[model samples]
Target: MKRNVILLATAIAAIGSCNEADTSKTPPTNDSSQVKTSTADNKYVNQPLVTHIYTADPSAHVFNGRIYVYPSHDTATGTPENDNGDHFNMMDYHILSMDSVGGKVTDHGVALHIKDIPWAGRQLWAPDAAFANGTYYLYFPVKDKKDVFHIGVATSKTPEGPFKAEKEPIKGSYSIDPCVFKDDNGSYYMYFGGIWGGQLQRWNNNKYDSAAQLRKPAELAILPRVAKLSADMKSFAEPVKEIKIIDSTGKLYKEKDNDKRFFEASWMHKYNGKYYFSYSTGDTHNINYAIGDSPYGPFTYKGLLLAPVEGWTNHHSIIEKDGKWYLFYHDIQLSGKTHLRNVKVTELKYNADGSIQTVHSQK
Candidate 1:
């Protein structure tokens, strides 16, 4: 329950409404007859890719065979002071690639840039990538110089990354939106925090020099801990047992009326054996669900997988592959807030006891 940052800036100022625009309007015109093409020969079909109005909280990962996609890049389009005056000067981090899943696209640009780090020169929020042994880890969030807010780590054997930030932040008391899971017994966990106090730590070793071995803000608030590492993943071997799993209104004792409040991406997964844990709520564009047999849980509320469609605002990632699943989210159009945020994918169902299914708008 420590998940803070004033509840992640009160769930990012209640989910949306930063309002900027008036740079004089006119700049749009790029119509190859209105885009969307896809003649099927692939390589990203007919190609023209340029949808940018400030892509939001994405975070996809497939790794080696490709599928990258890390979002957050809006420096302009109408209001954080006409686009970049504050709102942390518009934020950063953009990386995209595609190969399958509606197939096409061989590559897209901006592998990693926020002026290339240096404390992320201003916001650089919500990134999450992971490949492990062959390397590629990217867990973002920055804004220092006492403006507070931490979370950092970058490496790159190539997910198209020039990466490489060993440690400048990430030692922890409060960080934001990072999610990396590996467990099947192989360990590796790193679920980030939000709302001014956010939490879900563990990473004593999935490497990055173990961020100099953190752990000491009274052992870092303790709510939902894990930490055990050291089999070449790189560090920690002690702090276990903190998994309290939700209950301040974020629901899950069977969830009903306690109705969604967690607010900041969480996303831990397991599947067929159970343990789900998806998050984001009341604000961050509303998405919620829970399940838990144990990756530390008393979890239960499994509902609302996505929402805010025409009003545009939803946060997700859901992946599954061969057997199907998919979800990946983002919306809000008109193409001006840096591009207007677009990135969509659908098809997800479940409910025999697993729960999720009631969210609409694919149009």
Candidate 2:
């Protein structure tokens, strides 16, 4: 099997400088085998919910008694040939579906492509999907230029589209990694932001022209926030709340001089009555998680979910299937660069106290 060792020095440097305060609750010394066996004796071994390969950063949801996975196409190897100039082409969305996971992904094909969208020219990235009422909403990021990125939404009556893009992009101050969550009280909210120099922004109107008109630029640093949406889920309501979800005082592997917090890939889900926010940190390859009593604020660091294993930086998604949780993430198995990263999946477990057990790559 091929292995990646190019980023060894950089990975060490990043890991070495990571603040222990971020992962102090569950120290690095926790035994991996012990955590796995603590829940049950390999209860996940024969389950049909686990996937073997060819999928990564999976965002899963149940629609019509089937599990549909929407992940970015691993078209580029982060190599020079496929990476014309930038790291990725961002052209297509790969869709896989099964009557149930671990079974067979009966319908596997390119469900949506970049050219399919009206305004999108190129650069499609991570996408998240959810079904509400009678419509399926898919949220994703696309780059219009070198630094100009934006999030766009598409809706369809079925999980696999024929999805039609809105009249314009979902305008925000900064755009990347858009995730949607609906609360128990019947409200919808979206959270997203990554890289440096930008902050998370929430919109009262689900559809807006641009981040500039959505809110002031100064409001971006609030890690994650919640907004109220109209019942149709196509527009937002008045009186939005910009809640601070992540506290990045001394959590990064390297705290560079940047005003906006470096935390990206903000995902919010409520499990057992508490909100759990999972995100990527430590230069985008080191995955970390946090928990909060509410979706909006004061999340406490839970620690590293999975690190760069076999020379790969980890970017991930957490999904629950058949009464079990799985971590869907990406790793550069072919090279140290970002474009070559391939998607991977593994089982996830939670402790009795609601803390997630650390995740590792299966050898």
Candidate 3:
């Protein structure tokens, strides 16, 4: 955590300010959580940013002059694998950080543990971080006693914690993968939800329908959600709205269009005055984006951001530092097992036309 918090806010406020600008990925397409990743492709080996422990579903941000990463701490619990993602038995979170590009990454020991969260039952998945009112807020996903997933918030004076967990989860948060984006106007909007094991398919008519299956293949694919956050960055400031990702023809992506659909992991960034809503197409193994005029969008699909790396799942975050942009993500490169993963980073670029140049390796 840097003392000059205002500069950090300026960097984020600059996201849509200087600009306008910005997926977990899903499980394998074969309807199984087990994925065999190729290591020989060496070109896709973008090298882990930290190798001391396993981490995934990276949510990266700049705080002061440093970068703080909030990611799901992957653990090998040996819980039998299934479509419900039981194999991903992550129990806690450790914050990873760096001082600069190509700099030393520091693992800021346990920030929040499952044992400290009173409402949590099992699984602490992907998380995102934000700075407001001189306090750093960590937004995360965890399952409650009912086995239903919900998002929760924790707070710390520093970017990395020892964070204090709230006694309850956010009232309107359901499903998983929460991304909190701050607008140039100083408003904070949260984008979240995922299907398959991530459970976006389990909610019906805004209520939990444990038996609900995937939406019809011919109908529009499941959409991620967006809602403004309270000024305190603790609860929803408005009703949650669905975020639609349509194609060039204004046609909404259908369930069968798995290649470009929202699977999990929601992130928003502003560059050159455009809002880029990017996400992972679970099971498809790639990260993609859609561009819109506003934060809440019926965005038109652009194209791939990161190609399928050597894994069954993928999650990432993007930020501009020192006038250059970088993508922070994860893969099973360290253990070669789906449940264990490592965080990695690589330079990301945008074309003259404002479309992101698909990245396959570190620049």
The estimated TM-scores of all candidates read 0.29, 0.69, 0.87
Query: Per-model C-alpha lDDT, please?
Result: 0.51, 0.53, 0.79
What are the RMSD figures for all models against the true structure? 19.1, 12.0, 9.7
Where is model 1 more than 4 Å wrong at Cα? 1-54, 58-71, 74-113, 119-150, 153-167, 172-176, 179-277, 280-288, 291-297, 307-357
Q: Write model 3 residue lDDT over 1-363, tens digit each, in one string.
A: 001001011112121111000011211122113322323333333556655467799999999989888999876677998878888878878887777656656777778989999999998999999999999999999999989999999999999888999999998899899999988999999999999887888875567888888988898899899989998899998878888899898988898898999999888999998999999988777789999999989899999887776567888999999999988877666576777776777777888999998866321
Q: Which parts of model 2 have CA positions greater than 4 angstroms off?
A: 1-56, 77-85, 145-147, 196-226, 238-262, 282-284, 310-313, 334-337
Q: Rank by lDDT, descending? A: 3, 2, 1
- lDDT minimum window of 10 residues, candidate 2: 9-18
Alpha carbon deviation, residue 185, candidate 3 (Å): 0.7
Predicted model with the maximum lDDT: 3
> Which number leads on TM-score?
3
Model 3 is weakest, by summed lDDT over 10 consecutive residues, at 1-10
Q: In candidate 2, what are the lDDT values of residues 70-175, reduced to their tens digit?
A: 7766554343532122445556775666664344444344566778777676667778887788899887777654445667778888896656777556644235
